[model samples]
Target: MIPSLDWLLEQADRKLKKEMDPDVIAITRAVITELAAEGLPVGVAQAFRTKQEQDALYAIGRTRPGKIVTYAKGGASNHNFGVAVDVFVYADGGKRAEFLAPPDPRLKQIVAAMKRYHMQWGGDWGSFPDYPHFQLYDAVNGQPKPLLGPRYPGRPLFAGAERMDRTLIRLIQKRLRLPLTGQFDWKLTQFIEQFQRQHRLAADGVVGPVTWRHLFGFQR
Candidate 1:
């Protein structure tokens, strides 16, 4: 029941074919396979849910899915671009459920397993709450960041939409605070809006609920 080796290859962005040495891919696959060894590795699910998934699941403003999952749709989501993935839970009786819709207890098990594999849990992605997603991260010392350097030195994002200059934005935010807004000499509204786009925040400049909360806890 292990995932097909080819499926893992699709999970990576095309640029990965250029950047990732064969050894790197093998190492990553080994990691994921090893984590699922205890359970039946039932093959890889769609790495990232797209706008189509949202459309299918939502009849009204409310999500038809059992759990609150995913905030990003299409280009906005890390998944649509292939940076994240969802895993299913397998127990006895040969039952497997979508990780995104799995019960809470199962979600915890997946998270623990993901942590063991050194993947970042999407549940860590702020209050929006995503229990079944994981993304890879690389870091040295105590700082965690995208494995590829700025502009993805070797690996690049899939197709369109700028990769979002995370390092620069993070640097500016860290070096400067609310006062940094003054550095731009732009209206507060515009500043917040830009910040949001750069950091993958919802682009609403009001900073009403989620935006302000992330800013507060965000380091510097």
Candidate 2:
């Protein structure tokens, strides 16, 4: 049988409860409780990270030391926003809990449990397979949008020139050196398409994740 949440936390060294978003912390607690009920007592390995810490982690195996553990740098990761968490399944009376890759049974169970809480599993990512990671997601267009706050929509800002009259239009105009008309008309769409082509992104004229990342000087 599994132990109580307090007991489980006592068995671990890190209590990242204070470092996570309130909703994310609640969801994580629920997941942990449910996992324990099912005889799979998992331990929290990581939670929030400051931008400086994230930058340090990003430097691993590239500049500083250690192996490559993460792809995001500084402000690019959900961990920096207290929306992501990593977990590990403990064994031998909570004495040992190692990070396991895919094809591991415990990882599979954790993934399923996280999904029940409407969380996105990092193991499901196509480019980076992180079996021990999970985060809050807002469903949009059949895709899981990470909770990136209001300032960062975490999804498409504007697509297909639909919202043609907004402040973003003025920003785009200023960015492209066009007349500051504050209109997302066909001219702006054509300019964005050209920019997308130059940047090797899909020329859909929609300010999606890739486009926004590039426009805001984020690493792809």
TM-score of each: 0.40, 0.58
Off by over 4 Å in 1: 1-28, 40-43, 49-69, 98-109, 137-145, 148-220
Deviation in angstroms for 88 in model 2? 0.4
Per-residue CA lDDT of model 1 for 1-220, tens digit only, reads: 5444344344433323433333333324544454455553423454545567655544334546465444444445544444455555434433454554435664665666555435677678667666665665422123343333222123321112256344434433543354432222235457667777887877765444334334432111
lDDT of 2 by residue, 92-157 (tens): 767677787878887788887677556788888899788888878522123454443223244464
Instruction: Give model 1's clash tally.
Output: 0
The whole-model lDDT of each prediction reads 0.46, 0.71
* Candidate with the greatest TM-score versus the true structure: 2
